[model samples]
Target: MISYLSASYIYPVTGPVLKNGVIGIDPDGLIRTVLSAEEAKNQNIELVTFYEGLLVPGFVNTHCHLELSHLKGKVEQHTGLTDFVQTVMKLRGADDSAIELAMLRADVEMLENGIVAVGDISNQAISSGIKRGSPIYYHTFLEVMGFNPATAKASINRALEFKQKFEGFPLSIVPHAPYSVSAELFEELRLVAEELPGPVSIHNQETPDENAFFERKEGGFLKLYEFLGLDIGFYEPSGKTSLQTVLPMMSDRQKTLLVHNTMSSNADVVFAKALHPLLYWCLCPNANLYIENKLPDVDMLRATGVKITLGTDSLASNTGLSIFAEMLCLQDNFDIPVEELIQWATANGAEFLGISDRYGSFETGKRPGINLLDFEEVNGRIVLGREMRRLY
Candidate 1:
């Protein structure tokens, strides 16, 4: 049986908005076709489930840390990246039962928020069971971080072991962040990524200190290293931003997703675009404001013609895992068009994770779960309401 759903507006993500659009879906949730009300009327289609709001493809969260869900509200907000990292290190450990429960709740939350797919980061295999059983699609990133050059091989080996635990799931080995990975480890991970099947993700330029540390070896990261009791005697200043310093170590053959460009300049974006053929920039606006009390230069990034996606970092640094909320944040701050924001929240993320064929847009044969947004228009702008729900 085919179910027909119609709404005030339909955003397919890859195409123009359809007013009073009707979407035909198979019983298995695969999209069969999209047509206008006039087209449907011409075809003698009588039965339709009509909705009063906008309909869009379900959200794809490009970056998240499902393992850190237990840390929600435990850390203070607006503490800056260095202090935020220190706090997370101290409060991240908990009992197995507690961690599992938190992961389960976070998964449910994301689903209820109309998220159909996620690119989650995992340092351990603890969340494997939950992800395996989840209705929402998940691509786990086995995150490894080691600042000591001598332990580079050990770190990648450990990451590989964790990857084994997620055998049937879509996953890849990736670096945690620039501040926590050594040059040797970056090279080792690059080699692994070259052979890997998915895009690699890294936390990039989340703070000015990240650039300062690489350029002059002076910044809050210096204190971060001291707090971890790691010596960097052999490391030298690269005299460039962290993104510039690390982009060369990565493989241009493989796609790379750089998360949190809070301090990334226009030059950094240009350099990254020129050097890497396949590059994606992920924005976590709520988490950025929570940790650093700032947001990225959205105009600079957009102007550079870089592919941009959205993420809900983690419950540790955010109040909730809602892509709708992230979109509103960007809209409120940057006044980005709703159509463009929808692309970042849906198609762009699915493209980055290599799942565009199955998800992303509302194209025929794709099962990009349906989402309804009960929004209001004010002064020629979309004022998103809080009543977003999954309709599929």
Candidate 2:
């Protein structure tokens, strides 16, 4: 049996918006069809009215740190990424029960906000059980970072062991970032890519100091190392942007998701795209502001026509885990269109995570969860209101 849901606007995502649109879904939540209200009426389909909003596909969060859900409100805001990393390193460990409870709460929050899938970052096997039981589809990236060449082999071995611990889930081993990973570690990542190809997500160019550290081996990152007591005497400057150096090492066989990109320029996008055709750029606007108090050059990124996706980072660097909040932040700050933002929040992210077949857009045979984006009229244009509801 098919049931119909009608809304003020229906963004099928893969197609044009239908004014007073109706979507038909089967009992299993798979979309059966999307038609205009007049068409549905003419066809004698029974429709349920979802008053005053746009019905969209469920959000796909392309980047997150579920293991760090326990650190919400514990890490200070606007500390910059270097200091933020150090702070997380020091304080991420708490009582096991507290961490588990926090993970459960964060999971519930994302579900309430209509998140259907996540590309989560994991350093250890802590959240594997939670992810297995989650209603949300998860693709875990076992994050590995070793700035020292001597420890690269050990890091790869340990990351592989961690990957084995998540034997039943969708996952891949990936680098944490360009700055924290060494040349040898990147080679290890490449080997892993050759052996097990999947989507990869990594932190990128969130600060000027990251580029400085790569190009000249001098920046606040030096201070970060000093703070951590890391001996970087064997490291060499790449004399190029951090992305320019690391992106080339990635496997062209795998898709890569570059997160944050707060400092990525046109040249960086062009260079990275030329190296890997399957690259997707992910933006975490709220988390960027929470840590660095700056946003990516979104206009520059838009002009390049690179596929972009949205993420909520983690509760550690954000107040909550709503992609709606992430969207509002973009709309409030940038000149991007709501249509493009929705694409980033949905289809593009699902593609990056390799779940687009069933999660990105409202196509027949896909159970892309439906969400209602409640809106209000402002200056004669529809804009997102504070109220959001999950319809299916």
Candidate 3:
């Protein structure tokens, strides 16, 4: 049997909004068709369930760390990136049961927030079990981090073995970040990424120090390296922004997602677009504010016409894991269009994860979960309320 659902507005993301749109869905949640209220009435469809707010495709979170959920509230806020990293390194350990329970809770929290799909970062196999049994779709990015050039091969080998733990799930091996990975490790990861079916992700220039370290071999990160007792004496400054230094090492054919681009300038965006054909910029606004107390130059990124997506980062750096909250944060700060923000939270993220075929928008034969947005008009503009729920 097919059930019909109608809402105040239907945002297909890739298409124009439909007023009082009725979407027909099968019991398995596959979309059968979408029609206007007039069309449904003309067809003599009498059981249409109507709602008072917008209907949108479920959200897609392009970057998250389910493994770090147990660390919520353990780290201080607005400590800057280097200090935040040091705190996380010290507090990332916990009992296995505590970690598992936290992952389960975080998964349910994402589902409750109307998130249907996620691209999560995994450093170990602990999250594999939770993901295997989850109803929400997940694409795991097995992250590899090594700053020593001599450990590059060993790091990739370890990641290869770790990939086996997620045998039945969609996954890819990727580098952690530019500052934590050596040039040799980046090259090795690029070769592995060439064989994978999904895109690569990395924490980009979250602070000025990230660029400073690459440009002149000086920054707060030098202290971080010293704190870890790693010898970087052989490393040389690239005299360029971190993004520029690393973009050339990545394959132009590979799709890459640069996260937390808080310090990325317009020149960095231009250079990356020119060098890489497939690229995505992931914004985790709340986490940026939580750590660095600053937001990205979002206007510059929008003007560059780059493909943008949304992420919640991790519980370590955020109070909650809701893409709706992320959207509201952006809207409050930038006053961007609600429709554009919806695209970033849904379709654009699915595209980056290569799951657009199944989860991005409301198209026939797709099971993109249904979501409702309660909103109130403010000064003739639609301002989304905090009450978002999954309807299907």
Candidate 4:
């Protein structure tokens, strides 16, 4: 019932690396002790070893949308966020089976790619890995959007019903975005957050249009709201609130992760870091590029000291569900070190999701939910091995 991981490098967050490490795991999958190869030889266990591989904790993707897994390459760059949203709405209806299949498939992809857990945005009542086999922890953040004042309370009530239905799963209720959620609706959702759990997330500043619309009701989102048969003025929040508006509304337990913060003010990021020492700032780089063709200021986020986590958005907008690839993008464009980037996606992200006790590090008695980082062995580079289940 126990398993041992023989790794070249055991990167525990607390101390120096355990080189030529051997982690002895208990029958329940928690580690017993991380020791040297010599220590491992004296222990009684089943050993899993590779010639050249480093073992680290399973990666945690703080934000994603598994329901839109079917839309990976269907949308193009010229199509911004709103356009992608509309396209999914239209296409999701045309093929229900495909959407379900896509969701399950993406769940598997995440496991294969080494993602141990995710903070997913869920719509329609379908559960990712709920009915299927997925070895990943999911915190499904149910998305709520009701622009009509008449339906604000009713909308929240309905969401509460859904939360009850999925009470068996780890789930939560949250606003979709600043633009899409009305002030009254945000209040209702905030109330829900207070009663529910910690760590809520909302799409804060994904596009310039959303900013314009929130401030002046004067942008592409405003036009879309009108075209979609919704009124902008009816949901009037502060005419010009940004992070300033959301921070106060969010639970002081942790400012909800501000996603796609392409336009977060310096003051906002600073305030967030001050409010929560381990505040998570989630980045959906591909989603930003797919809709607006711009990325959030990565350098600014790194400088602000906000812990960063990666999300693949939906399969509809990305090439694959790979945090490794996401890290590659960060390094390609932002100059972040591989080790630090790995921590953001792995350790820090797990801390934000409130599952660090079970999944974040290669501690002596922790689950090292591992994913194959690289396929080939090469010199002057790290080589990760096959996907392995939690040792329990």
lDDT of 1 at 235: 89
In TM-score terms, candidate 3 sits at: 0.98
Ranked by lDDT, the better of candidates 1 and 4 is 1
**Ranking by lDDT, best first?**
3, 1, 2, 4
* Candidate 3 lDDT over residue span 101-179, tens digit each: 9999999999999999999999999999999999999999999999999999999999999999999899989989999
Off by over 4 Å in 2: 377-381
Candidate 3 pairs with clashing backbones: none
Task: Report the C-alpha lDDT of model 1 over 68-184, residue by residue, as the tens digit.
Answer: 999999999999999999999999999999999999999999999999999999999999999999999999989999989999999999998888899999999998888788899
For each candidate in the order shown, give its overall lDDT on alpha carbons.
0.92, 0.90, 0.92, 0.71
Give lDDT tens digits, candidate 4, residues 1-392: 55666756766655566667676666666777777766666664454655355566778888888877777787776577777777777776546677778788888888777888899887657664453356788888888887776778988887877776566777778888866666778778767876776678888787777767657757677667766887555455466546666566566664467788987777778766666553578887866776777889999888877778788787777778877777766666776655676688788888778887887777765775754343234466443333333222
- State each candidate's clash count: 0, 0, 0, 10
lDDT of 2 by residue, 1-392 (tens): 88888888888899988878888898889899888878888888764756688899999998989989999999999999889989998999899889889999999999999999999999999899899899999999999998888889999999998988899899999999998888899998888887779989889999999999999998899999888789999888989999999888888778889999999989999998788898999999999999999999999999999999999999889999999899999989886666788899999998888888999898888999999997776776667777788877
TM-score of 2: 0.97
TM-score of each: 0.98, 0.97, 0.98, 0.87
On the 0 to 100 scale, the lDDT of residue 349 in model 1 is: 94
What lDDT would candidate 3 get against the real structure? Answer: 0.92
Ranking by TM-score: 3, 1, 2, 4
Candidate 1 vs candidate 2, lDDT winner: 1
Higher-scoring candidate on TM-score, 2 or 4: 2
